[model samples]
Target: MSTPPRPGMESLSLILLRRPPNPPDLSDDEADKIQQAHLDFLDDLRAAGVLGAAGPFRDHDDPTLRGLCVYRTTLDEARHHATTDPAVQAGILIADPITWWFREGEIHLA
Candidate 1:
């Protein structure tokens, strides 16, 4: 009937990347450049110890769901990083981050 509280939970940000309406049509070169910049941003986050995991989805049911970013930070921080992403800035992708709570040190990415 009632749920019990769980201890040792960590607050994380789960960013859901979606397709932007009226996204810009870019040439292959420009698209590649934006992608590279996007990767660079992720790398920067990783170096700063803010990013937990991030990657694009493949063969998924939802077409709008492009990728995701799990951050070891609050929603505000994750939003800042997502909005500043080159891909998001270029309208290649959109980022919507939500708070996620899980057992600390339970999930790991390789």
Candidate 2:
């Protein structure tokens, strides 16, 4: 049987990154800049030890479902981080924060 979670342990949040249905028309340069900014944001999160994992969905050609970011933070904080993304701030993308439950040490990097 699986053991219960330890005290102080709680669920995290996963930001579902998606392209807006009616995305604003942005110049190629502007789009590139936003993309770069988003990358930089994720990098910062990783360095801050809040980004559990982040990557794009390459299984199909679904533009709406772009990627996801697993954040080791509260829902409010995760939402704030998602909104701070340049792409989201620029209205190029949208984010939906989903609660995730898992063992504290279940996830690890090699």
Looking at model 2, report the run of 10 residues with the lowest lDDT sum.
Answer: 1-10
Q: How close is candidate 1 to the true structure, as a TM-score?
A: 0.85
Best-performing candidate as measured by lDDT: 1
lDDT of each residue in 27-91, candidate 1, tens digit only: 99999999999999999999888998999999979888899899877778789888899999999
Model 2 residue runs over 4 Å out of place are: 1-10, 103-105
Q: Taking the tens digit of each residue's C-alpha lDDT, what string does model 2 give over 1-110?
A: 12336654446678999999999999999999999999999999999998888999987877699999998788888998998999899999899998866666666642
Q: Output the TM-score of candidate 2.
A: 0.82
Error of 2 at 19 (Å): 0.6
Worst 10 residues of 1 by lDDT: 1-10
Instruction: Give the Cα error of residue 30 in candidate 2, in Å.
Output: 0.8
What is the lDDT of every predicted structure here? 0.85, 0.85
TM-scores of all predicted structures: 0.85, 0.82
